[model samples]
Target: MAIARTWKSHSVLPGFGLALGFTILYLSLIVLIPLSATFIKSAELSLGEFWAVVTAPRALASYRLSFGAAAIGALLNAGFGLLTAWILVRYTFPGKRLVDAFVDLPFALPTAVAGIALTAVYAPNGWLGQWLEPLGIKVAFTPLGVVVALTFIGLPFVVRTVQPVLEDLEAEIEEAAACLGANRWQTFARVLLPALWPALITGFALAFARAVGEYGSVVFIAGNMPMISEISPLLIITKLEQHEYAGATAIAVVMLVASFALLLVINSLQWWVSHRHGRKQ
Candidate 1:
């Protein structure tokens, strides 16, 4: 009797183990190590100290403003970014390429330069602000300014994320929906949106995360008022300037935890949406 021959399956890419090891090492060095140091530094503080630092009135106010502004900015970006992406993908217009390139200006421009430019454009004496100030719509040197700055910086993330997904989506799908007696609104709501939902959520999350950690751009426009316009990252910087390393670490850790939780919830929702859509198909 002849013995049966056995064969092993392998991945086409070579050095799987080596690649994985490099990936782990890179992540450990870049991400895990730095995050671990924050926790370790904060551990020097007693629970009461940590609680007091993070829950103080000023700290709490900063947390509220940071999260609130970031959320508002992300929401604004999601709406306008989707619209912008739609226009870019579906239309032909003058300066379309220039407009698309301009969308990424926030990414390449130095944050401080963006901040200065925004302040110059939005200050009470600035051209745009001069026009709006008469109507009592103040923007610069306020919490609203923070939101505006965040919205400016965060817009690119949403646009870039959704743009490709929109481009890949064939126009025939929309035509098919229309042929089935669906109106434009119905087509968008039922057909286009479902396909774009995952990318939209990803963009929103990234924009929110970026806004939360933003410091330079916000600092210039924010006026850095302690309980008013000062953000969490600014607060952390203040602690560091005061040589309160533990306090700074505690605040950072709190922000990290809260951000992680929010991202986790958003990811879970995205997964559910994808799974449900798959099931329906």
Candidate 2:
């Protein structure tokens, strides 16, 4: 008799092909089409013109401020967010629920409103700014202001991402490490951190992406001064206002490509870390 072959597959949901087809179609309509249009519009410019537009002094300055501020802000958020999440997960106190709810304020508040409030609090002669001015430190209308705004908006991302991971982490692991004669720092560094690393990276990438394209919040405090505190999104708007559509699209394309590349790298790192950790188990 001839040999026979058999295959079996299982899924809770039915019509897997149909569901996947719908997902791809929806994504293409919403995301792929718009992005393709942006690229096509930018393609109207010649190579030399595209290069000039992206490499202009103002454009270069905006890129530096935008990426630099975002990187600094994301890094700050990672550290502080981890601490915040740790406290929320490991300890309980009065008004704990209120404090947890407050973490999502940035997600709920309008960006314009947040910008106005930040400017009011940080501008020279404004509450905190008044005290800092005499110390020769400035916040509003400076690159530092941009970083502050980015940090404020991006903090929630890291917190939310890492919070769940921390909650799922059992306290017994720490106890076990201590039982093995590990100090507090050693327990954290050797046990907790490995499990949290992937989530932390994901949060950092999310924060960085959010900060890069932020416009409304950053514009108010940035003073819109070209080559000083202006950001890339603001620069794109400036180009658009001048009817330089091609130039605007060119800049947008650069931002899109750079952000995508950075996120891709971060995601790959997250996957690799998760895979290695899994193998160790």
Candidate 3:
């Protein structure tokens, strides 16, 4: 006798259709509609106007500063984050728990508060800044300050992303590599890196994305100087304050498109790495 196919066998969750509908509805209301409105508002400008708005000297400068600083900050976080995860996972020490807890401080701290604190610490008359200024280094109210703020907030993304993966990884793999005559660098590059590469990419992408859209912490440290330290998000706010809604939307659209494109590239890289690794297995 023939048996009937059941929905329960295909899906663990009951009401799959209902769940799918709700998912789409929720996304439409929360994400799609708002994004659609941004596109529509930006369309108010002529194509030439849109191009001019997004490509103005000030806009280009802001784009460079924003994307460049974010990329630098994310890259910094990736290396240090990997090191931190390795230490946290592979070693036991006093204050380990406290250090782990401190990693989440940026998430819990208010963005404005974090900005103020960083500013105070890095300001000319402030603690670290007072020492650094005499040596010709400036942190507060500069492009470097933007980078510092981005790095501060973005660190947690990288650390948290790699931590769980590091925890699940077995130390025996390293021991086996060493037994096979691999040195420390060789073991890490040949053995550990392959396992950690995907997680590292994910963390980098998260940090980059977070830093790209960041406003609060960057604004205070960036000095709000047009074409100098101003970020794209801050530029958008400036346009809005001037009641140039179309201009603001135009900048927003550029940021959204660029962010989406970069993220897509990162995710594609991740998928390719995973696929290549799976084939090796």
Clashes of 3: 0
Clashes of each: 0, 0, 0
Q: For every model shown, what is its TM-score relative to the native structure?
A: 0.93, 0.94, 0.93
Judged by whole-model lDDT over C-alpha atoms, candidate 3 comes out at 0.93
Output the number of the TM-score-best candidate: 2
Please give, for residues 68-158, the per-residue lDDT of candidate 3 as tens digits: 9999999999999999888889999999999999989988899989999999999999999999999999999999999999999999998
Give the candidate number with the greatest lDDT: 1
Model 3 residue 174 lDDT score:
87
Candidate 2 lDDT, 1-281, residue by residue in tens: 22354453556779978888999999999999999999999999999999999999999999999999999999999999999999999999999999899999988889988999999999997999999999999999999999999999999999999999999889998999999999999998988999999999999999999999999899999888988999999999999999999999999999999999989999999999977773475
Candidate 2 or 1, higher lDDT:
1
**In model 1, what is the error at residue 213, expressed in angstroms?**
0.2
* Local error of candidate 2 at residue 163 (angstroms): 0.7
Q: Which sections of candidate 3 miss by over 4 Å?
A: 1-19
Stretches of candidate 2 above 4 Å error? Answer: 1-14
